[model samples]
Target: MPDLLVGLVVLVGAVVQGAAGYGMNLVAVPLVALIDPRFLPVPLLLIASAHGLLALVREYGDTDWSGVGWAMLGRVPGTALGVLAVATLAERPFSVVVGAAVLACVVLSVLSWRPRPTRGPLLVAGVASGAFSTAASIGGPPIALLYQHSPGPTIRATLAATFGLGTLLSLAGLGVGGQVHLTHFVFAAWLLPFLLAGFLLSGPARRFLDGGRMRVAVLTISGASALALLVRAAVG
Candidate 1:
């Protein structure tokens, strides 16, 4: 039953991410963590990597690889820091911190504060994304904020490409830290079908979600999910 619930959550998250360019971790990680704590960080990172690859292919022409390279450079050190956090911090405390950070990002994005995607900002965003994503499996907000004002296809494609590479680094960090196991891969495999289903469903809805109103809605949903994680951490 828990697995089923997590799968459904992942399906919904995948659809949102496919259309919006980001939000899968924000939407699904909190709910799925409640269902099964073990199905986090590493497992979700694996699934996200796959989802990102598919999204990138669908919007291949829109990808901005130059920016992605700088982000990857920043991610290397950030990922190392995240692995250290995962090894040291208690789960509840880490969740609370991650939730707070994500909420803060959403608020900033909501205020129409569009930071230019210069090399410095992209690198900074990448560092933050790598740390948060490696620790909590929720890394999209930082990168999403950077590209929020761009065209929908560019946002989706660029983010997909960045996440594809970033997640690989995250997975490697988890593996070296002994946080990943064979079961994580098995669980991710089980959820792949649902993820693919949601991706397919997003094809027709992509245009609809690309509107300004829909972008606001997506940010709201992401904020709400982050709040949920914070509340859960507090209560637990």
Candidate 2:
């Protein structure tokens, strides 16, 4: 039952991410954690990595390598910090912190305070993304906000590239920290089919979600999911 629930959550998250360029972790991490905390960080990172690879292939030409490089540079230190946090913090407190940060980012983005994707801002976003991603497996809003004004394809492709690489980095850090075990891979294998299904469905959904109004929907979904994470953490 837990596996089925986790699969369903990933399926939906994949579709959201596929269409919006980012959101799978925002949508899936909190929900999956609710079902089974063991499915976090590593397994979800693996699934998200696969989804990001597909997005990068589909929109390869649109990727901005310079921007990706800037973000990755920041990710290095941020990833180290995140690993330290995950090792130190308790589960519920970690969830609370991550949820609060995500909600704050969503609110800032919704207020039309987008920062241009310049070198400094991109680096900052990358660092924040890396920290949050490694700690909570919810890293997308920081980079997504920086590129909110970009073309849909560019946003999707660049984010895909960033996340694909970032997730791998996080996974490595987790492995070294002893946060990843063989069971995480087993769970990821079980959920792979659903993740692929969501990715496939995203192709059709993207046509409708690639418009200006889609930003509103994306923010709404992000905010709601963040709130859900907060509520769950508080109740627990």
Candidate 3:
């Protein structure tokens, strides 16, 4: 029953990802961690990996491969470093850091103030996304910010490819860390159908949602999620 509940959450997570071009891990990881921390990060990575691929397929012709390629250059190394750091940190501290960083990004977005220097920002965004995603399964902000300035279709396509690479890097790093196990793989597999269903349902919404409105929504939800994590950390 718990796994079933998680599958449902993954479905919702997938819808968010499909509509917003990011948020699979943002929504899934913290929630799943409530059920099982050991299982949360790796399985969420796998699920995101699946969604990334599906997204890439859906937006194949629209991608800006140059952006994705440059992002991956930073993401691959950053993911490795983040996995190492996470392996050494206590769970609570790690969660707090991840949540805080995500929240900060959200606040900045809501204010309509973004990082400058568009061309160079992608590398930094890639590194941040890869690191956070690997460490805490909440790497959406960095890449999402990068995509926010792009045309809608291109934004979606580039994010799909970029996140796909990050997930691949994460899989390799987690396997080396001894965090990837049979149970995680099984859980991810079980959640796949539901996730796909949610993504399908969200496609129309994504098309119709105005970019400005979506940004506000993303910022609001991300801020709220971050605040909840901080409160949870304080209590625990």
Candidate 4:
């Protein structure tokens, strides 16, 4: 039943990501914490990495390699900071951190902020992405916000390229920190099919979501879930 619930969550997240460019982990992390906080950071990272690969395949030609490179350069230290976070924090506290990060992303998304995909901005986004992604598996907002003003294909493709590689770096850092374990893979394996299904559904959903209509709804739901997660963590 837990597996089924998580699969459903991943499916919804993947579909949102497919249509919207960057929302899989943002949607998945907080709700998944409600079901089980331990199924985070690594397991969701694995699923997100897979989703990014699928996104890359469809939009590879549109990828901005220059932007991806700049982001990756900042990701190294960001990942290190993430590793340190995981090594020091306990389960409930870590869950609170994840919830807080998600809340912050939701707040940022609604702001009148319109950051561009310039090199300096991309570097800063990359660093933020790495730290958030490594720490909480919620890395999409920083980079996605930067590329939000770009063309749809460019947004999807560029973010995919950056996240695909960045997720790997995060995994490696977690592994070195002794946080990666066989159990994480076991959980990720359970969500594989749903992730694919969500991507498939994206072709149809993108038309509806492209006009920026869904952004408010998505952010609202994400914020609520994040708040719930924070409450749950605090209570526990």
TM-scores for every predicted model: 0.88, 0.88, 0.86, 0.80
Residues 14-55, candidate 1: write the lDDT tens digits.
988898888887778778877987788677888999999999
The number of the candidate with the highest lDDT is: 2
Q: How close to the true structure is residue 214 of candidate 2, measured as C-alpha lDDT?
A: 62
lDDT of each residue in 12-100, candidate 2, tens digit only: 99998898888887678767777998887678888888899999999999999999999999999988878788789886788787778
- Residue-level lDDT of model 3, residues 83-181, one tens digit each, is 777778876787798778878777677676765325578788778777776665566677676566555567667888888887777678668868788
lDDT of 4 by residue, 120-183 (tens): 9888777877776766666776677666567777778888888889888877776887999999
Q: Residue 73 in candidate 3 has what lDDT?
A: 79
lDDT of 1 at 20: 87
lDDT of 4 at 153: 76
Worst 10 residues of 2 by lDDT: 213-222
Model 2 clash tally, residue pairs? 0
Model 3 lDDT, full chain set: 0.75
Report the poorest 10 consecutive residues by lDDT, candidate 4. Answer: 213-222
Q: In candidate 4, residue 133 scores what lDDT?
A: 70
Could you tell me which 10 consecutive residues in candidate 3 have the lowest summed lDDT? 209-218
Candidate 1 off by > 4 Å: 88-98
Q: How many backbone collisions does model 1 have?
A: 0
Of models 3 and 4, which has the larger lDDT? Answer: 4
